[model samples]
Target: MQIVIAEDSVLLRAGLTGLLADAGHDVVAAVGDADALIEVVERHRPDLCVTDVRMPPTHTDDGLRAARQIRERWPEVGILVLSQYVEERYATELLATDTTGLGYLLKDRIADVADFVAAVDRVGSGGTALDPEVVSQLLARSRRRDPLERLSPREREVLGLMAEGRTNTAIARQLVVSDGAVEKHISNIFTKLDLPPTDGDHRRVLAVLRWLEGLEP
Candidate 1:
């Protein structure tokens, strides 16, 4: 996959470039600021962009703003944002629209190269790849009355895993249950959340996103 990277930290930028290159992906451009990121992306039109949440100048949300702009202007390009902290507000904004080809992962997750690479692949293929910590933070900070109150404990577990972009088979393995059981829990979760039936993984993710968005401040 062809990728463009945007990070103000020189060392981290070099690390990310090396990681992607070692994984056999092309690093079309690795830039330091959001403006350069936008320029390079427009010029290269790479398959994916990995960007930090903060960048040069203001050092606050520049990368995220750039990601949002990229989503608006070049909706076909995939975006995966990395952050040192879980900023629920930024995460919400990034996911407010269609979440296809979108991801938000914690920078620490890069330590697990295989998992990070899988996340990149997932986002490039138009799938969600939210950090589990981000999911937890969103759930914990939610101020809205629990729409999720109706779900059983197991069903809520299923929903959390769903929000983390786990497949039914993967969730089953994690929970030590059968795929049929996982599906049943998911079905119950949809009913409890009042989400209409959807056939694809993308729609399932959308349903979870809608549920989470309802809990936002």
Candidate 2:
């Protein structure tokens, strides 16, 4: 796949370029700031654009703002946005649209290189990727409805891991359970929480994000 990148950190930008190039994806252009990012993206029209949520001159939501613009002007262009933390406001904004080809994740998730690339691929193919922590915080803050209150202790544990964005295999590893059992727990959590029956990972994440959105102010 062809790609464009927008990130302010020099080390991370270089590392990401190397990672993507190693995966046989072409890096059409990479820029240091949001404005430069926009210019390169429009020039190259790559398969996907991965950007950081914060960039100069304000060090605020420049990347997200750029992403929203891309969604507006080039709706078909895939976008993956990374942030340093699980921000409810940011998550809420990103989830407000039901558009495909979008992802919002914590920057540290890049350490899991395979998952990171998978996210890029997912978004490029029109999907969503969100940090698990974002889901957890959202779930945590939902004090009123308490849809999750009925879960058993084990189910609650499984729900927490899912919110952390763990795959069944990874969650099984963490919980010391078989993959099959992890799958069962996830299903139970979904039933208990009334989550959508989307089998896709990112879509399931969006379902989780929707539930969490209710808790945000």
Candidate 3:
């Protein structure tokens, strides 16, 4: 896979470049700021872009803004954002549109090299890879008056795992339930959330996005 990296920290940028290269992937460009990231991405058109959520100038959401723009212009390229903290607002915004080829992971996840690489591969292949922390924060902040309150505790658990980009089989395994049980729970969740039935992988993403959007101010 061809990848472009955008990070203001010199040490972390070099570290990520070396890590991905060691994993048998090509690092096409490593840039410091969002502007350079946009330029490099447009020039190389890499398969994936790994970027920090904060960069240069004001040092607040620059990388995330660039990521949204890239997704708008070059919808084909995958994006995985690394953040030091869980920014639910930004995550919600990034996922508001098409959820394909999207990921938002914590920088601490880099310590788990294998998992990080797997997340990159997953997002690059047009899948979601949201950090567990992101899901937890979003769930914790959900308003009591929202439709999410209609779900049972078990259904909420299933929805959380789904938001973390887990497949039905994976969710079943994690919850120690049968695949049919997981499917039923998901069906209940969708009905309770009032999400229209969709026949695609995006239904899970859309359901999660609907829940997240409700938490926004």
Whole-model Cα lDDT per candidate? 0.90, 0.83, 0.92
Compose the digit string of candidate 3's lDDT tens values, residues 51-117.
Answer: 9999997799999999999999999999999999999889889978898999999999999999999
TM value for model 2? 0.64
By TM-score, the better pick of 2 and 3 is 3
Clashes of each: 0, 1, 0
What is candidate 1's TM-score against the reference?
A: 0.67
Q: Best TM-score goes to which candidate?
A: 3
lDDT of 2 at 149: 72
Compute the lDDT for candidate 3: 0.92
| Lowest lDDT 10-residue stretch of candidate 1 | 198-207
Q: Give candidate 2's error at residue 180 in angstroms.
A: 50
- Candidate 1: where are CA atoms >4 Å away? 144-217
User: TM-score for all predictions?
Assistant: 0.67, 0.64, 0.67
lDDT (10s digit) by residue, model 2, range 1-217: 9999999999999999999999889999888899998888888888899999899868999988888888777888898988899777767787788658888889889999999989988998888887788778867766545665767899877766777788889989999999999888777777776765655555457546744663478
Off by over 4 Å in 3: 144-217
| Comparing 1 and 2 on TM-score, the stronger one | 1
